[model samples]
Target: MKENENKNEIVEIDDVDREIINLFNEDGRMSYRKIAKLLNVSIGTVHNRMEKLTKNGVIQKFTPVIDHSKLGYNLTTIIGVRVKGGVLENWEDRTAYHKNVLCMYDVTGEFDAILVARFKDTSELDQFIKSLLREPDVQRTYTQTVLNIVKEDLSSSKML
Candidate 1:
């Protein structure tokens, strides 16, 4: 791993680090001993690499991939938000922690920000949209209901 003067340092990884990440992606709870055996390295090496990866922000967190649909959140929507000038960051800060928001992005398009969110049903979605409109900085919104999700993988290990 390489260090930088700034907090957001860009860390470099080698083949061993890639393998360790790939194994963890396969099973977040996999034992370090198992990873060491698979990679033909000592358990200490795996532990050290993982510690470095986490410290460098490569591994943000170990979490399960949930099936929201199974939990009654079957409705998914992509919303394009148009915010009043100079308040997009404020709006994002407020909305980012909302329970329904899966991910948010600032993109190059007609809209200021895009939000991907899930809801239990249309009523919940309606209320959520109305709440957004009630915000002072929100000018308008265009929402698209997702009929099908062909691919949704939130794993960074695949990029390795």
Candidate 2:
């Protein structure tokens, strides 16, 4: 993301757009009729604006959050990975096939990549990490088990 991204793009919206996004950010399953009533707009208008927003990539995807513990995946971990050969750039392909890898990031810090993962047990986690180490692009990794989940923000409120 560039610092000049918003400066280069123009996004002009009335108060209704802001309110609708806020309401939807709070709950994605809210009905369009409810949104229209709250904003005092027609259902058609709400539908059109939401459609435009979705098409323009303002709203990426609607998804659910799950309790993995119930599924027997009780371990959570954050890994800091340093890699080579531009693997950081192709992380989408690198991690896409991994179901337990929840998220990957090319971040600015002590590491080149960061990954959050959930696993059924330590052996599975060890195998995953071992394979990651075998990648010619990957050099080293550091990881820590997560004992608590303080907050989870899926909607990215700034966009709303």
Highest TM-score model number: 1
Candidate 2: C-alpha lDDT: 0.81
Q: Candidate 2's residue-wise lDDT over 37-152, tens digit each? A: 98999999999999877765566678766788999999999999888755677754767469998888878978987899999999989988998888888888898999888886
Best by lDDT: 1
Encode model 1's per-residue lDDT on 41-60: one tens digit a residue: 99999999999999878888
Estimate candidate 2's RMSD in Å: 3.8
Could you estimate the TM-score for every candidate? 0.93, 0.81
List per-candidate RMSD values in Å. Answer: 2.5, 3.8
TM-score of 1: 0.93
Q: Model 1 — which ten-residue stretch has the worst lDDT?
A: 1-10
